[model samples]
Target: MSNDGHPMKGHRFVAWLIAAGIIAASPALADTPTGAARELATKTCAVLAARVDEIPGSGPVFLRSYDSSFGQGPTAEPALANAAFTYDNALAAIALTACGHRAHAQRIGEALLSAVNLDRAGTKGRLRNTYRAGAQTQRPIPPMGWWDVVASRWFEDPYQVGTATGNVAWAALALLTLSEVTGKTRFRDGAAVLAEWTVQHTRDGQGPDGFTGGVHGYDDAPQVLTWKSTEHNTDLVAVFDWLDRAGAPGDWSHQAKAARAFLDAVWDEASGHFFVGTTPDGVTVNRAVSSLDVQLWPLLLHGALERWQRSLTYAEGAHAVDGGFDFNDDRDGLWVEGTAQAALAFRAVGRATDADRLLAEVAKELSPSGYIWATRQPSISTGLAIGPSSATDDFRYYRRPHLGATAWAAMAALSWNPFTGQRLQPVRVRTTGSK
Candidate 1:
């Protein structure tokens, strides 16, 4: 999103100026963790909520991603036109709500709900992937697989669209959280619709495994990518757990049971860690790639403390960087999104000191203009090129200010738990209304 204000040159510059003023006005408070988090959240939230592109009647919608040097779309073509992802907007909604920007949160939530309805026109209430200018972009990018370096090619196809289980689950979480915040049944109902669609379309039953975790979702031709994902299943488990706790209408326990079974099937008892995903034929992918998400999610969402500790230990040895965590075991440079996520996960598992250290490192990556880099480097080609030439491409890469990284950073700063929809500091609470 362009940060240009009517009188101001750009939003980034103005945001930095405001942040400087806040720091200068209260140096002591700014030095403290609470103050630092509040400052970072305020600055990042402002940039995230900036209206770079304004639709005729809808007013200004949040830009999906931005970068001062590279511009938008460094990662995907649609981002260049400021195409908003349903998942990214959901993240913004949750972060905004947690940071006490209720009005901003409501605006994002409503827009997303409208987008969902528009996309669900013929699907009988299934949520689609993305919305740009109030219309669904049926041809959206699939989920990013940073671990498999050649995976970028999968997203290069413009005709490809996916209803990723993780995306759907996250959208449901955001809607459910928004419902709690606003006392709006519409948001809850929207969440239920997504949950139902996930149950009907994503869950696989033919395999020996009870639930095939979940499919990679569907493409434009109504084709399903039959790979079952441990990460996506973990996400569903959290989603169902949240729904169960919220008293929302759904067979959450049943969903969670199947999801847990999928997770158990993928778990490597010897290593005490979960594999990435399994193909329809049951061949495992990404077994060698040490995924930060795989390491962090079980602990953060499922409360698997022993496994969490083991995974953390493995990650530190395999993917640790100077100030942040790598995207995977092979990658040398830090993945900004993964780092921010690791920080929150650390706090969730009672590693406050470790979380603080990681957050400090992540803060260093923030630009003077108040944006977070998607990664420390432009490309992760170095690590990806290590294997045989036939295995992967040696493509160059670039970095940009990613909305997902910025959102996670804000959530980490505020000690907000995305999985449980609770704050980590002082003590965890069931509802958003509590401090």
Candidate 2:
């Protein structure tokens, strides 16, 4: 079955139905956190692999985001058709690899590498923001360039294809893992290039606050530099560490140190939480934002027991509901990706019971046919934006199955680290590696 829970056509559909029936019949199989996670991962991966459109040289490109209003013309146009975001595909590759699907992981990795567009001047080995599966005369894919907000929104760029630090970090991590899994030098070479480029662009001591957050890629028009993301820098720390562990030649100590310094500068000591990030001018942004990812990511990747406890308490009290976690403290609806990610974080921090509970909550969002919804809502909304929104209370896209969310659910189930494709286990404070 497709992610929408609609019956897919072809032999794959029949196989999927049989698989789903088996899963549904055996409630015991779905009772355990890992069992349910593996089942969902296997089933979802099969369907996603079957449905994806393969580019000749690039292999399969998973859908980045789905709009329920797809094919509905006039005011509502299809925004994400044939478009694949690098970061989403990277995460999918990690999840598939963790689930023992090396072929799928390699396919995704190759596709990402094949889709690389290196037109931007400032950065080397920079990937395009998004890639189209096939050419379309009516609405050809936008030209590759630096991130331009006006052009992006006006043109309806679905994946916001640009040189985002976070996206590149993820892509690099994915490539490194693919290299390890496939023993291919090309993938490792690709990861090294990205890592080197990232280190070059990193802002170490230039900022007023002595922050190490990297610049937010190149932007067009005004050509003004934008804010830096603490989350993205944290991701870079993990990326460099993974590359080092994989025996890549680069000396990643400096980059890792810089990334950690940026994270430290952004840490809110009193609150026991890290701030969202710093603006271009070095001022902190989103101090009031209470997002699950903002807290969970640091805890999962960089272990801080006290901070993890505090963040977990905050997430549970402020963002979590019966179904899942809200997008932020201010938002009323749950975000499926964040919830699944939080489950992994819980497991990493030795709170297996909490992790299992979260996994169970996510399991409730899965269809009998094994497709997991992006977000489960009490009712559907009439908004055009994808996923949940505060204004319209629209849940159409939220209720639909999403590639990224399902992949994250699979990752959470295995207690897999997205950075290294390793099973998550609690660790004490260490001095040997990047934290």
Candidate lDDT scores, in order, read 0.61, 0.60
The most accurate candidate by TM-score is 1
Per-residue lDDT tens digits for candidate 1, residues 1-435, read: 212212143345655547655323322223236644555565555655443222323332444545445422254444334445667777877877666666666777766565455453255345445545332223321222223255544332221134567777888888888888788888887877777777887777544242333322344435455667777778788788778777788778788777767766776757766777675454454464456777777666644535435667677777788678877666667787788788777787678888887777666556543567677765553222211222564532346666677788888877887777767642232321100
TM-score of 1: 0.77
RMSD of 2: 6.7
Q: Count residue pairs with overlapping backbones in model 2.
A: 4
Top-scoring candidate (lDDT): 1
lDDT of 2 by residue, 98-149 (tens): 7666776777776665544233343347665555433222222232223346
Please report, as a residue range, the 10-residue window in candidate 1 with the lowest summed lDDT: 426-435
Clashes, model 1: 1
In model 2, which regions exceed 4 Å deviation?
A: 1-35, 52-64, 67-76, 116-123, 134-159, 202-204, 207-225, 283-286, 302-306, 367-371, 378-399, 430-435
Which portions of model 1 miss their true places by more than 4 Å? Answer: 1-32, 35-38, 51-62, 68-79, 133-160, 206-220, 282-286, 302-305, 381-397, 425-435
As for candidate 1, its clashing pairs are 3-11
